[model samples]
Target: MSDPHYDREAEKYESPIPSREHILSFIQEKPRSKRQLFDLLALADEQKKAFERRLRAMVRDKQLSCNKSGVYRPFSNRGLLTGTVIANPKGFGFVALDKGGKDLRLTSQQMKLVFHGDKIRVRLLNKKLDAEIVEVLETVKTLVGRLHLDGKKPYVVVDDRRIKHNIEITELIDGCLDNQVVVVEMLSSPTIDSDAKGKISSIIGNYLDEGVEVDSAIYRHQIPAVFSEKALKESAQLPTKVIPKDKKNRIDITKLELITIDGEDSRDFDDAVYAEPTKNGWKLLVAIADVSHYVKEGSELDSESHERGNSVYFPHRVVPMLPEAISNGLCSLNPKVERLSMVCEMYIDPLGELLDYKFYSAVMLSHARLTYTQVNEMLEDKKSPLRMTFSNVTDNIDFLYGLYKTLRISRQKRGVMDFDRIESQILFDNKGKIKDIVASSRNDAHRLIEECMLMANQAAAKFLQKNNEDFLYRSHPKPTAEKVELTQKFLTAIGLTLEGGIEPESRNFAKVLKQAKGRDDENIIKTVVLRTMKQATYTPVNEGHFGLAFEDYAHFTSPIRRYPDLLVHRAIKRVLNTTSREPSGKMIEFGTHLSMTERRADDASRDVEQWLKCEYMRDKVGENFHGVISGVAGFGLFVELSEVYVEGLVSIRDLKDDYFIFDDVHHQLKGQRGGKIYRLGDMIKVKVASVNLDDRKIDFIPDFG
Candidate 1:
């Protein structure tokens, strides 16, 4: 019964069963009468009932259903079944089925009839899990955002970043000019490539004004900026602040030496930290905003948060996860006020290895709120007054700093691939217009807190793993063999070598990165090493994290912005309570959904940021900047500008001196006659020739004289 050999699955097809063996033999068998065959292989009384009961339950739950009817019956009530469109980036789409063979794949061309997120029907053509798009039932019409011209044709660049294509805009609302953003309605009448015709309905304005802030807020998170009358009414009716009556075993901890360290402009203070040297080691406390407590499950507020997924922060604006009533007020861990929190109590020894940890529902006091800039300044300056403010806690501060350094070193020794990726921030004026682009350097304060959060996350994962609990883990698998080989070649070309032999551990990559410090190509090497690694994703499987070099890891902090952390909180609470009931199948399902949602949110955020940055640079078409060759593609070479820290393409035509042919596998372009090759990480200067704000792309011409 435990092992289902070939014969068992054969029997399953004869008898109606759910999830038969996904093999050829089971699918290749001859037809049988549906009811009679099932009736023939029936088991003894209770066992028969149990099997039928499970099958019925699965069917009733809409998780499974019968597929094809037999030849014993002439009219086999089966043609094709279909549902919503799910897709992948490589341009393949799936049509959900119910006559229930398998989810069908709709080729990119077939999907040209119905865009992603459209509900459509499909016909079976090849096999189970394969089909052709038959019809589209519904298309999502109205999209929110700006109108930008593509070449000479204009396109409605929707605020929803999940939309794979930019719909062309035909009708325009007056008072909106080129590069002047506006939200538009997509006319139901189909247009270019399965997309709908669209027209500008409203102006969101230029990127810098107050109205633009609201627009940025909506554009970043895809959340409606203007609240519905009903929702706003509910907010207006609710109490402004938490009264003392809401207190549970309340004791004020607002006067303790707890401090918040974040960016200078961060308004939503979700976490506050405090630490001091203990007897055996050090005592570290991370008090995070108790958002889950305030936003109860199944409430309107809860539904809103779930839909938004998380707060979206653009370069000059923010879209909050929770409304101002909660995120910026009662639940915020601000100084001089009592705020409830869930705390992680950590113990670490002198060697910087985190020894043990526990989580608790606690209230913490913060004496001073600190910013990263201020902390960095104080650490560098001997006579800074901020050090004196921590006079009573000076030893604690020193110990914590020393511990952070030790942990960082320990992390490196364990082969943790330290990726110091540079991010560019566009400075905005009071009017919200982009004034300049600046690259923000990662400092010790940022790394210190990152290390702290990592410790907590790792400890949480270890706890769940050791307890044999059903939990979603943050995992990054080993890179593909092909990717590793490519990485080796790139590193060798860039004057760096992966140290621990041909087959090197992640630690070898880390060592190369460490040694590349102060080199001109440091960023290039770091970027290459990063690209060679696998992406971190969440799963129920404990695959381990390759980048952090941990056997197990999870996201336990940042409950405010991450749903997985909230689930972790619930899991920890369940364990603490030691209840009779454990997490059901729904718990795992929810974890999967949340993980997927988190990734979706990330993609949307990144897409919007790119669009905004590209839009900001659109007006400065002729500007020049020194740059490096970030990538070489078939079409052209990608130049990363040093001044703006933005990347654009230099089309192959621009390389006029020599006819270049793309050397595909090696990631370079060869001058066919001259034998001069342009490759990845090659430094050069470029002049921005054109910008397509709608496509969020810029064109460059290589200044090769």
Candidate 2:
């Protein structure tokens, strides 16, 4: 009564199908057509539909792939490579090679099937360096974005410009409005033919609300913003003050006239210093808050602290690694408070060479909490108000100043590279809008405290090394050959040369920097040299610090914020207790993770600052300003405004007069017909043409008239 084919298909849909393993095993041996596979398995007509469903599932899982000939095989049999997709705002992407080769470029059409940060398997197209998305192993599951409305439909646009797709919202949370910043939970992964679906998880706030810029950055970077319930409970139950028993084994240094010097806005005072001149040289005592005593290993608080790795400092707020109860209350070296500390007592010669040092737990009281400005005033005039107020520690402050001078000379002799870069600080209004971006000044007081901390850190590193204790060291490797060559070419283009052989030492770079000082392109030269240097990272293997020119260097201060410092403290304590245990293998993994978290925080902070800068410039469109060419690229020249410290791109299209060609070797963009060149460090006038808040970009055009 029914058609034979329809009846057969219906019967196949109702029958039992072969196991996925069997199907995979058969296909993995050799590529097989769908009909051939069905026949090989001896599947009945009634099982064909179920077999097809399983095949589709396998393909979706990336375990199987279908060829143009309708043949299927295990993905492993194909010569596809696995990598993570880094999407770009321009609709294209790159597959970061998993095995450390050149990245495979992907066209916009291929990028449409995947999102940024997706783990994917890609196949090279025709033996070229370009790849096509073959399968997506994983998709971005959560995102922070702004909510949008399209007629009757609502969607979320991810703030990360690299992701070019809008997530269609299936459900909206209460209180969510159009254009509000919200966190979204993806409901389904994207496929080649469909977009990702999501539901609003939490509404952050209005787009332009106070603190929303920082909040958005926090969420976008996946920074842990809140302490766990267990950590909070532990913090709440902790003792607010140090007790008598807590000071049992500690050497009492409460009478040493120690003082804490910090920035005006610093909250958590971590280290206090006291120095006195000796017949031989000087005696320096550096006391740091013993945060490990309160937050023990394997505790809930410690777990959370380790996960956070380090505190993140934004403009007006901090995402602390430890609870405030510990970081700011119990462990802070507040003035007049008796706190537990780990003290580094060092004897240095007049030449700033360390003769000897020892570490011990101690009870110390900071006599005064002085700011850099106050200390600078006191140093310049002994009759300053702050000097009179804290007269008890005036002699110690003066001795510290003398010791700092000695250390400065020693550092110069040691060839440490000190780049005189101007750092900017944002002044925020009550509503958190940027009032001004001013250059942060460095004074004598800042240098004094820095030298003191450096001596202490060096002492800690040497102590751990001599005792053969396991510890994390801050290591900076020399520049790579490729980078060195590029730097040399750039230097030559600027009418300079890098001395000290092929592998130039830090002193050579220092010499070049000194030579470039007061020059018209001083900042540019410094920036280029800095770019040639490699980034410093924490490692268990000591490779020495190239920038500091120290044979051994580790971060031993600020344990309240940095995890590496905490580990150093713990290791020192273990050595003090005469224990001989090596650090666990897990410590290496933790070091790597901590380094990544540090970079993540830096990136997140920069993102927030850029967003704020864009908001600040929104109202200044069409205003003229003087700027320096900070970057040169094929598309445009990046100019940093001198008045606001805001950087914007001057697109080549807006150059107007001539076509520009990028010169990568010289880091310049030159015009074809006009012969005009835009190079790094060249000062020029520009007008703010546009500000795109959605993309967090500012655009500028040359003001030739």
Instruction: List clashing residue pairs in candidate 2.
Output: 11-46, 12-46
User: TM-scores of all models?
Assistant: 0.77, 0.90
lDDT of 1 by residue, 1-705 (tens): 222453664585555333333211222354334354345444444445545554434333433333323212111225746687776555567876545445777666555556556776555655555665445667665556556764577776554433556667878777867766677666763422345667877777864434463464454444544445655555555555555665665444555577778888887787777777877777787777766666666767666666655666656666666677676777777776777777777898766778889877766766667788767766678588978875655554555577688787779778787677788877877776667878988888787778888887888788777666666788888877777788777677666777655456778888888888888777877887788887787677788888888887988777676666766666665666664244357655665566656665666666656666776778878877799899888889999888888888999988887999997456689998999898877788888899875456889987655
lDDT of each: 0.68, 0.88
lDDT of 2: 0.88
lDDT, model 2, position 45: 80
- Which candidate gets the maximum lDDT versus the true structure? 2
Q: Residue 323 in model 1: shift from native, Å? A: 1.3
Q: Report the Cα lDDT for residue 308, model 1.
A: 57
| Over 4 Å off, model 2 | 1-74, 77-84, 94-107, 120-138
For residue 391, model 1's alpha carbon misses the true position, in angstroms, by: 4.3
User: TM-score winner among the candidates?
Assistant: 2
TM-score for predicted model 1 compared with the true structure: 0.77
